[model samples]
Target chain A: MTEAILKVEKLKKYYPIYGGVLHKTIGYVKAVDGVSFEVNQGETLALVGESGCGKSTTGRSILRLIEPTEGRIIFEGEDLVSLNDEQMRKRRRDLQIIFQDPFASLNPRHTVQRILEEPLIVHGIGDKNERKRKVVELLETVGLNKEQIKRYPHQFSGGQRQRIGIARALSVNPKLIVADEPVSALDVSIQSQVLNLMEDLQEKFGLTYIFISHDLSVVRHIASRVGVMYLGSLVELADKTELYDQPLHPYTQALLSAVPVPDPDFKRERIILSGDVPSPSNPPAGCKFHTRCRYKMDVCTKEVPDLVDVGNGHYIACHLHR
Target chain B: MDLDKAGENVEEDYVLEVDQLKTIFRTEDGDIPAVSGVSFSLKAGETLGIVGESGSGKSVTSLSIMGLIPKPQGRLSGSIRYKGKEIINLSEGEMREIRGNEISMIFQEPMTSLNPVFTIGNQMVEAVLLHMELSKKEAEQRAIEMLRQVGIPRAEEIMKEYPHQLSGGMRQRVMIAMAMSCNPSILIADEPTTALDVTIQAQILDLMRNLKKDFNTSILLITHDLGVVAEMCDRVIVMYAGKIVEESDVRTLFKNPNHPYTKGLIKSTPRLTSEKQRLYSIPGNVPSFKEMPKGCKFVPRCEYAKDICYKNEPELVYVGEDHKSSCWLNIEQAPSIEEDAS
Candidate 1:
């Protein structure tokens, strides 16, 4: 946990909304507005929030899959935002991303062999025979057998396709993998299998993951640290145990309480927030969560709170908290 | 003297009774038996939850009860008695009267369930008028009141709008409002909160719980999430491959789950409060009915399956007082459990 593999400072990705016929920029949709975090080596940092909260945009921004509006993405002590196309492409070898949909992410036409070998070929890592050997080895690492190499993506089930996705992410021996909702689309029984395979693979390869998901239980199980997002900003950041045990921020507390515990005998008081998440395009004044926050005060609707570290690296953004 | 009279002791107590219900879909390929001999009863104001993953026939069972299964595609058998009256053989007109008036259902996707072209007020008033002998003015007034009761702000303005004008949560609230306006004796909520996010899901679940208490209406809640079953249900039935594998009171099912599948399901779901090294996942895909095994459907994935388990299908037998499990292990140990209980 000492060495930081990735550091993001005030990262922002704002999509410009255009006006009528003239097509002029009317305003910007601050999708990922002023978000920041760091990932230590071999530790999973989970970004959790509902849809339209910019969690996916942040993940894509770090990978430079989506162009950022502002801020620095420092990977291995170098700012990634400043790198040119060639340099960024070279840097991409160490940075990879796995999408949420297994069915859509993989090319339908390509067999497992071709899909796995594409990364090695593009990176100029090995000869044809060596690349073929590496593809089979990658498949073995992700728990897929050699016989599946000849099959296409559609031929496999959701879990197996996810394994293929994981196998493809590991083909170039990348250090970091931005897994965005990897298991949410899978069935409950299959979700656990995929999660177990990921944990095992992470241990074997010393991989750092930025797991973005909405399910709190899955996040609590896998993440070393968690960042709670709301309306394109980090509301709270803490260790997984500390966050779940004593969440300081109102939004974090509400989110943790809202998630239903599986055990029928285990009854916890749930904080049911009224109404839905506000539109990210036209956010409310001051604290974005003020509309639904139970502990809302006058100052909450007047001034925006900064992310302040209370103690032991637990940071929260709320008016009630220091 | 009366053989059928033996099953009448508890029949009068329940608001709805479903016995030996099986629904088979006649596909082009072959007959796919989805819901096979499912039996359960819902008492007035009791929330009976049916939980299963996809293809477990949870939805089909609800559809069968509601008489919503499309004809020429489905074949339903067995008894569905509402207020001691069988509904399976009723005509379309009588069935429609019971469907919207006596029993209303809210499906998972509110966006698709509610008509797109109709205004929220228009459709809601239509449901009220069709069910009750209310005038247009009274029904419109009742619709607005129902919308407000479900916590939709600006109810008057919302009714004038369409379904697409509302968010997923708002649309669901409207659906609940429409369903509750009739105040049906039994409400079938089929994965009502699965489409929304967690925050909104919490809100909807709270609304359902409160509505059940205030109206004293029974609910046939069907969902895949075990957490939801724990939070909202009085009793639960865990289904697997078109059969009820386990049925018991909510607490007993969670604490002393006898079926291996039930145990695996509880273990596999990650607890939000604790950290587990790895989740215990059940292996193998749910076998399609086309190539289903002859014996127990869960035979391929049961960790405790013995030679006998693979030879014959286990019937749902009483393993404990007021609890049942369909597993050979439980059947073999039934006598021992009886001795222990005594």
Candidate 2:
């Protein structure tokens, strides 16, 4: 069995909502509430859900980009949560992130070379000449020509800009990459190109990926294991084949069914949830998805179901499953 | 689906017919042809989908039909017939009569399209009051009724709420409510669900389908998602570099896609059942206007490009019954199902 590269236990990130004249803390928006997962080495673990499911927040928290309110993020036997800012900064050399929007993420003023070299420079990896050569190598690794290195972010297409972003993330030779909706902003053709590129890069570098995306099809393509998050908690987690084929959780089933199949003749049993996802700030008790779940039970409203592995690593959190 | 067979009674047959429509924008760089000589017809109650990437000119075609293109900078040519009457060059005042009353449009970004300051009722009533003749109180009731029809909960309360008060799904439902309030025969929805999440997108698509059935409204859906097209559209037009590469029924387009670009698009989209293999991707990017190839616009990316493909472009020709593909291979001989480039 593959060894775990990162293990997150009861991870939580809550933003306090202020109210009253003195702006006292009224309530907490539980963005990521008690989420737990283990990402194995050289495997892609995809976290998928609708928007505001705290998938992005979880990815950020794991990287220490957003400080976790309470959790133990065990990375290489060391708790990342306990690390000081300076210590965390040093650890960043082995951890990287690729953002959703290539247009917004990349600095428009800086050339591709400068953007790629920035991480290397920050990590104090190599000297000027060596850094320059490394930048060219990184650009080539991400499928960009060396001549285009002098061009600004605006000069490249959406696909090429994402390549530059990947190149930047790879400059420091990170082991784990948290790519947050890496291909969502791209066109269909370009999206495939980038997805393929990412897959190729993963194999070449033997890297682990925490792919956070709302798109199910893209996740199905890239992920070895899949975790379906709802409200602020993981409702289901399993192997990609098991998750897609037989989703135990109601939210997972609904999410998979909601994805429109491309073939016109492909008839699918769609579980169209009645209303929008409930507000995360004041989410429903017990199962947060109880408001939208079709098979809502009495136990669902009063007691939160624990994410317990049914068998073969297929973990489900639902009253029905219990 | 055949325009010639529809005969002289074009108004009674097809709701909207766009013939050789061309829209070009005069930019600082040069004049870029956004939508060049694109032609298609929409029958009443029929959903025609235009699928393409970002700069593929799908949105431009819809804007041209709406007469929403800004003059001086953006020039529009060719003919846009609404119920057999040429309405392409109608004056702003003349076009206003047909804009919302006869044909209405819903944009991708509901937030940007909807005015934030005004309440939902204010916006809905304004659209109804503009093209429709009704009292303010009557329009308010109509707006609430429309909101209720689109599946918005607490319709009365929602009418009082601003655009910001609602979720992304709710905002989109409101947008549909506003678009349908006038009960336009032809509803032009440009990526209405693109900004939405998968679940919300499903909701919106379901709403659109229901609304179409209820109103028997002809829809012009402009989107890049083939999945959305398969779910919603009857006929699909595959656009690339401001030209229609293929046109067929949704089923045929998916089953037996004729154009190389069309095949590439379908294969490239990561499917739920797709094996964990390297996704087949088109070799190169869409050519810019300044650097468009002399022969085929897709020649730069086409693996099967021959000598002829680099010299002269192919016209949209019939490959099968109710199907058309613009490719040299289609003209040369029946295209063999070649394996995708590795």
- Model 1 alpha-carbon miss at residue B18, Å: 1.8
| Best candidate, TM-score | 2
Query: lDDT per prediction?
Result: 0.90, 0.91
TM per model? 0.95, 0.97
The ten-residue window of minimal lDDT in model 1 chain B covers B333-342
Interface CA RMSD of each prediction in angstroms: 0.9, 1.0
Clashing pairs in 2: none
Question: Which candidate leads the pack in DockQ?
Answer: 2
Q: Return the DockQ of model 2.
A: 0.83
State the TM-score of the second chain for every model.
Answer: 0.94, 0.95
> Residue A71 deviation, candidate 2, in Å?
0.5
Lowest-lDDT window of 10 residues in candidate 1 chain A? A260-269
* Residue-by-residue lDDT tens digits, candidate 2, B255-305: 889889999999899998666578889887998898988998999999788
The numbered model that scores best in lDDT is 2
**lDDT by residue (tens digit), candidate 1, B54-150:** 8999999999988988887999999999988999857789899998789999999999999999899999999999999999999999999999999
Return the lDDT, model 2, position A136.
94
